[model samples]
Target: MAAAARASARARPLAHPNPGVAALLVKDGCVIARGWTQEGGRPHAEAVALAGLGDGGAEGATLYVTLEPCAHQSARGPACTDLVIAAGPARVVIGQLDPDPRTAGEGAERIRRAGIAVTVLDDANARASLSGYFTRAEFSRPHVTLKLAMSLDGCIAMADGSSQWITGEAARAHVHAQRARHDAILVGGATWRADKPRLDVRLDGLEARSPVRVLLSRGVAPDGVRVINRPSQIGDLEGVQYLYVEGGAVAAASFLAEDLVDELHIYRAPILIGEGRRGLADIGLTNLADAHGRWRASEQRQLGSDTFSAYLRSR
Candidate 1:
């Protein structure tokens, strides 16, 4: 089940409207087949894995899946539960339940009715892997991650708003790689005018992973970016499971104030620009206690002279 969750990571940000899922078939403790959701979410993980099975096949084998096999049948694709039932697996282990209204728990129920043993396992890793789809299903908005690069003094740029190179090349490269994992990259008008960033993934062979560009502004903007007038309207962003926010202060603060930020990425350089613009703006919090339980640090690593920090929202 843990391996299935890791495989699902490759399906993310593209399998929007569908949870990123993966499947593994094991026989006598040796893996027989492995698969993840494809682009556009067709040919689900279970279907792909079953197709790869040889004559040694799935009969009496155990199947592990990141999410419960979807029960909803559509013209677009075959029902995963139906396929799994026909595969004749002796047992099915699911990392989590599907959150879609149609297949919330029906998938596993159907498989169990067929006399196959079905067990749903709960773990922190599986929950984090499905966070994007879960957020979309529950909140109707994509999972928002705010990435901020700043100096040790809590400054993003100098007094004149020039923050071209706060972190080293390694840190910049890391941000681009992170962009490849999101469904869309959003920026405020101020950021657009300041840097005119392309917001495209530049990593070799992963150029196709460049996410949809978004401009979070009401006014006229660039030619090819999605314009969003307000953060409340984020729920309308179609086909986006993960939304990455690279900000210039106001944009970052706005999402935080609205409680839309699900994760926070902070990149800090050793240098300090003392008399400079603050990395974060007023979030309208009355007391420090209110901020205590809001975010919990999950990761911290050193990248040359910069420090990378990752935090997940407490709730």
Candidate 2:
């Protein structure tokens, strides 16, 4: 399941409307075939893995899939559950159940009816890899990730608002890579006016994967930029399963205040600006106790000279 989850990461926002699933066929404790969801959501992971089998095939092999094989057939592709049944796997281990109403539990039921054993597991890695799909399936909006770069003293810039590079090149490259994984990237109106950032992926060979540019403001956006009046209107963003918010103070605070941010990424630099611009504005918090249990740290690492920390909402 962990290997399948790692494979799923390669097809993330690219799969959009479909869950970025992965499948592994193992026989005699050796992985024989592996596959992940292809681009544009065609040829699901199970089908791809099944196709990769050689002479031995899937008979008597155990299939590990990150999500339940889809039972409902689509005009674009065949039902994955049917394919798995035909492959004659001894057992299917599913990391998570399908959330789509069309095949919520139907896929598992069909597989079991075919005389194949099915085991469902609550896997953390698989769930994290499918966060975008789960968020979109349950809520209408995308999974929101708010990213901020600050100094050791928790300031975003000097008091004059002349902020340039806070973290080193490695962190900036990492941010661009993250931008490529999201369907859209947004910045507040104030930040847009101040920095005029490109807000696009700059890494070599990934320039084409730059996310849709979004402006969080009521005012008119420049040519080719999408606009949302407020953070609550994130649901209106069509086809966006993942939304990355790169910010100034006001916009970051707005999303945090509304409790809309599902994940938080913090990049901390080594320097300190004593009396400088803050990383966030008022988030409408009355009691400090309310903030204690809302976020759980998931990862922390050093990127060049800066420290990067990631947290997930504990809901």
Candidate 3:
């Protein structure tokens, strides 16, 4: 299941309008076929895996899938549940159930009725891989990730307002990778005007993956940038499943205050800058206790001279 979940990354963000999914055909403790959702979401993971086999490759094999096979038929293609039924896998292990109302639980029921064994697990990794799809389905908005790069003393800039290169090259590269996974990247009006950042992915082969540039402001947006007056306006960004918020203090605080951020990515450098600009302004929290259970650390890693930590909203 974990391997199937990891395989979903190959199709994520590229499979917008459809949940990125992966499937593996295993027999006698060996994988016979592997496939992920194709670009533009055609042919689904199950179909792709089944098609990869020479002939009857799925017969008596156990199929592991990150999400349940979609049962609804579409003009684009046949129903995935129908494809799986025809492939005739002996057993099906689903990491997570489909959240879409049209297919929810029905896909598994259809497969089970065909005399196939079905196992559905409440897998965290599978759910995490589909976070953007799940968020949009449940909340009518993108999954928000707020990113902040600061110093040991939690400062984002020097006393003179010079904030260039807070972290090393590796950390910057890491940030770019994160940007590529999101559908759009946003910054506060102050940061947009002060830094004039291009906000585009610079990685060698990933230039095309650069997300849409967005500015958080009431004023007119620049030539190519999109604008949103308030964080809630993120819901209006049609087709944007994931939003990466790179911010100035005010913007970060605004999103945090409204509890709009779903994930936090922090990069801390080795140096300290006392009496400098803080990483974030007040987030409307009067009591520290209220903040204690709001976030839970999910990842911590070292990148060059900086350390990166990720936290997920506890709720």
Reference-based lDDT, each prediction: 0.89, 0.93, 0.92
For 1-315, candidate 3 gives per-residue lDDT tens digits of: 898888899886777767789999999999999988887788798888999887677889999998999999899999989998888899999988988999999999999999999999979989998898889888899999999999999999998889988999999999999999888999999999898999999999999999899999999989999999999999999878889999999999999999999999999999989999999999999988887888899999999989999999988
Model 2 regions lying over 4 Å from their true place? none
Candidate 2 positional error at 233, Å: 0.8
1 against 3, candidate with superior TM-score:
3
**Candidate 2 lDDT by residue in tens digits, 252-309:** 9999999999999999999999999999999999998998999999999999999999
Error at 300, model 1, angstroms: 2.0
Q: After superposition, how far is residue 81 of candidate 3 from its true place, in Å?
A: 0.5
Candidate with maximal TM-score: 2
lDDT of 2 at 24: 96
| Model 3 spans > 4 angstroms off | none
Residue-level lDDT tens digits of model 1 in 50-156:
99986549998999998888888899989999999988899999888887778899999999999999999875677788888889878989999999999999999
Judged by lDDT against the true structure, how good is candidate 1? 0.89
TM-scores for all candidates: the values are: 0.96, 0.98, 0.97
Could you tell me which residue pairs clash in candidate 2?
none
- Residue 263's C-alpha lDDT in candidate 3? 100
